[model samples]
Target: MSSSQPSPSKSAAQGPGSPIADAAPLSLSAREPHVPADRLVAEMVPPPRFDSVRFDTYIPDPKQPSQPEAVRVLSAFAAGLGSAPSAGKRRWFGKKAPAKATGPRGVYLDGGYGVGKTHLLASLWHATPAEPQLKAFGTFVELTNLVGALGFQQTVATLSGHRLLCIDEFELDDPGDTVLVSSLLSRLVESGVALAATSNTLPGKLGEGRFAAADFLREIQGLSAHFRPLRIDGEDYRHRGLPEAPPPYTDEQVTRAAHATAGASLDAFPELLDHLAKVHPSRYGALTDDLRAVCLTGVAPVPDQSTALRLVVLADRLYDREVPVLASGVPFDRLFSDEMLNGGYRKKYFRAISRLTALARDAKGLVAQ
Candidate 1:
C-alpha cells in the first residue's frame, strides 16, 4: 500500500528550486549558509516522511471538525465522570456505573467524514480545564508511529506529560496496533487518562470485518470499561461547504485553496458564499475570521467557555443568519453504513472518510427557508 501512496499531482509555488527540505538538517544550519549551493539545492526537497502514513498524518481543518458545541458536551461528561480508571475495579464488582449513560461515558463520534470528529475531540482538549493536564490528539496512527520511532517504553514515557488524553480515532486496526492499543489503555488506566474518540464504527463493527467477531468483541467488551460511547450524530459538515462564517476578499486565498485541494468543488462554492454573503455581510468579519482561521491554520484552538471552535460556529452563523443546511451523503441518519468498511486493519476510518463527498453536498441551511 505504501508503494501506492499518492504523490501530489500538483505543487504550490515555492522559491526557485524550493528552499525547503527534510527540515531536520536545514533546521540545524548555522546562522551563515555553510553548505555548498549545489548541495543546498539538491537537498532542499525531500518527499514527506509520512507519504505512506495517512491515518496519522496531520489533517487540514477543512477535513476535520472545527466547532465547539460538541466539546462542551464531552467535557461535561468528563467532568462528571472524573479521572479514576474503572475497567479493572469494575471487574471485581461485576456491575457498572448506573448514572448518566446506559452504555459508556467515553464520547463516541459516529458519523460521515469531515463532520468534525477530530475537530470535536480537539475542541474538548482545548475546552477542558487545565486541572487534568489533558493532552489532545496523539491519535492511533501517531501512537503507532511513536512506537516505531521510539520503543514502547519511550512512547509511554512521552505520554506521561499529561494525565488526561483525548485520543482520536482509536481501533485495533492491525495485530501490531491491537497490541499497542491494549497496552496503551491498560497503562493509561494505571496512569489515569480518560479516553475520548470519534469513530465510524461501533464496538461490534470490527469483529464483523475480520470474521473474528468473537475475538473483536472480547477485545472491546470491557474496552469502554471506564466510559460510555457517544456518537456524533449528523452529516459531514465539510459537505455542508463553507458554512457562512466569514467572507473571502482577495482571489489569491481562494485560488490557493483551490489549487492545493483537488476535487474540492470550490468553483461551486463562491456562488454559494455569494448567495449567503448578500444576506449577512459584515465589516467586522469575526465570523469569517474564525472560519478562515480554522481553514488556514488547519487547527481550531478550542475557545473558552463562551465559544466553540468546530464548524458549529458556522451552524451558529447560519442559525443567527436564519439559514439551515441539508444533507446529501450516504444518509446514515437512517442506516449504520459505517458498519461496512471496504479496507482492512482500519475499516471505520476508511469508511468515515469515504462518506465525505456526500457530507459536503448534504449540508443545508440549518435555518428554515
Candidate 2:
C-alpha cells in the first residue's frame, strides 16, 4: 500500500530501545485462506473472554435502546470506506483541486462500561475489507506501549500504511498519553488512515476532574472534531446475570484445596492471565473489567523479573476491581522473592501485596461462614 508518509525503519516496528520490545508482535491480520474466521477474529481483536461475540449476537439493553442507531452508523461507516475516494484523487477545472470525501472520516463510539463499545468496534473491524497488512487492531493501552517503544513519529509512520485502525478502551487518564494520542489522530487522519475507536468516556468529557481543566478540554475538543460521535447507551452486559452473593469460598481456598489434594489444578487462573495478556498485549490498564476472580496453586517463588512484574500488574488489576484472588502452596508473602520486590517496580509490588493481603483476609471471613 502506497502512502504519503515515509516508512519507518525495521527497528522501529520491532521496538529497538524500549522494554516492551520483548512483547508479542503488534501487527494483526486475518487473510489466511485456511484460518477460521472466529479464530482470526480472536487473534486480531481479543474481546474480554468473549471470542464468539459479534454484532448479530450483541443483545441491546432495552432500557437504553440505542443499538439501532449505533448499528446503523457502524454499517454506514463500513460501507462508506469501500466507496470513499483515495487520498490522491483530484478534480480538473481551471485549476486542479482535491476531490471532496463523502462520508465521515472516522467514528468515535462512546458509552459507559460493559455497554458493548468493544463489541461494536470489533464488528466494524471484521466487516471492513482490507489486506492483512493494511489493518491494525488493539487497545489504547497497547497503542501507548507501542508509541513508547517506537517514538511517536516512527509509530505513526509505521501505521500510515494501514487503511483502518480499530482501538478499544480509549481513555485519557494520563496527560502525556492524551497529548500523544491527539497528535497521532491528527496525523493519521491527514494521511487518510480511517479510525474506529471505542471509549467509556466521551471526547468532550475525557480527563474531566482528573487533569488540568483547560488542557484536557482543548485536547479533547481538537480530537473530537476529527471523528463523528455516536453514543451507545445501554446497561453493562457484564452485570446481566451476576450472582447476588459472593462465591461461598474465596479463590485462595480453592487454590489451597487443589494444592493439598493429591491431584488438583489451578490452570484456569493462568489461562485467564493469558487471555488478559492477549487482550491488552502490552499494558494492564482496562483489565479490571474483564477479570473477576483468580486462583493460583503450587505458587513457588518467582525467579524471572519480567514474570514478577506481570504478576504485579495482574494483582493491581484485581485489586482495583475488588476481584477476589486465591493462592495455595505458598503464602502470599512468599510469592515474590526479596530481589523481585526490590526491583524497578517495587512501589507497584508493594501496593499489590497490601491489597492482596487485605482481600485475602476478607475472603477468610466469608469462608468462616
Candidate 3:
C-alpha cells in the first residue's frame, strides 16, 4: 500500500507551528483493483456495514408507522421462505416458465435516503431462514454488473437456486437494465426464489423521468408484478440528530492527517475522480481494500455526468465499508452542478451527497485544530 506520491518531508511538519504529521500514507490512485467474476458472486452478500444488522436492530422512528409495518411484513415474508425448494424446482434452465405467481413473490421497500430501508432490507436478509449461500444481497448496479461479468443466462443459472435475493438501491435508469433484470427476476421467481428490495423510487415509478420509459412499459410492468410495494416515510435519518458536517480542512491538514493515519489513502481529488473513471463501478469496493480513511485534497464539482455517477458508486462503497472521508476544497454538497441536481439522476446524486456527508462527519477527528 505504498503511496504513488512522495511522502511529505518531516521538516514540512516541523516548519514553524505546523500541525502536519510525518508518516507516509497509501495511495488509492496507485491501486487498480481487478475483481474476478467468481469474486463478484462470492461478494454478493450484504456489505460490511450491514452484515450484522437484524430486524430487532432497526429502531423504527416512532413517528413513521410505515417503518415498523415494513419490518413486520418483511419478517413474515422471510419466514415464508423457510422451506427449501425441491431439487426439481431448483434448476431454472430448459424449463417452461412457471405459472404466474398467485401473489407477489417479493417485497419492495420504497423510501427516501437514510430512512433505514437498506437496514431493513439487510435485516430481512439476515432473518430469512436460509444459509448464507442460499441467500444473496446486492445493489441493483451490482446485480447488473454481475450479469455483465457473467453472461445473462449464466447469471440466471447461478442465482436460480437461491431461496432469497435482496436488492438494495434498486433503480431502472437504463432501458437495457430494465429488460435484463426483468427477465432475470422472472426466471428466479419461476424457480421459487423469494425477493426483497429497497429503493428511493417505487417499483412502478422507476425510470419515469430517467429515460424514454413509455417505450419500455411492458418490461417495467412485468418487473413491478414480482413485488409488493411498502412505503416508509421519514426525514433523512443520517442528519436527523447529527450535527452539520465539518467544513473542508486545509490541504496541509488533510495531507498531514493522511500521513499520520495508518491505512489511510491520500489522493488529489481530481486525480482520484479520473482514476475512478478507468475502474468499473463493480470493482470500486475492491479499490478500497484494507484502507481506513480516504483523504482527498482539492475536492471540487465533478466535470460531467459520467464522472459524477462513478463518484456516486465510490461513495456508496466507502459508506458501505464505513470508511471516513477527509478532504479539502469544496464540500460534498457542491460536488454536482445545479443542472445535474435538477436532472433525471438527481436522487442518485443526492444519496451520494448524504452518504459522503456522513463520512465527512466521521472524519472530523482527523483534522488537527
Candidate number of the best lDDT: 3
lDDT of 2 by residue, 1-369 (tens): 111222443544644333222222211111011322233233334443334556677677777667878887787787667654334232212334346475567787756545777777877876677665566777666577677666888777777656788876555445777678878877776667788876554323333532222333455557555577676765545445643323234456664443332211234434444444444334343333322344454455665665665676566445444555555545666667776666544544554565566455444432323
> Model 3 — which ten-residue stretch has the worst lDDT?
210-219
lDDT score, candidate 3, position 238? 94
Give residue 285's lDDT in candidate 2 (0 to 100).
36
lDDT for each of the candidates? 0.38, 0.55, 0.82
TM-score per candidate: 0.42, 0.56, 0.87
Worst 10 residues of 2 by lDDT: 24-33
The list of candidate 3 runs beyond 4 A from truth reads 1-23, 84-102, 202-219
Name the lDDT value of residue 182 in candidate 2: 77
Q: After superposition, how far is residue 226 of candidate 3 from its true place, in Å?
A: 2.3
Taking the tens digit of each residue's C-alpha lDDT, what string does model 1 give over 62-128?
3334233355466576465444433434434665633333344455555444455665565555454
Weakest 10 consecutive residues, lDDT, candidate 1?
Answer: 24-33
Better of 1 and 2 by lDDT: 2
Point out where model 2 deviates above 4 Å. Answer: 1-44, 47-51, 84-98, 202-218, 248-252, 256-369
Q: Could you tell me the lDDT of residue 93 within candidate 1?
A: 64
Candidate 1 off by > 4 Å: 1-72, 78-105, 131-134, 202-222, 241-341, 345-369
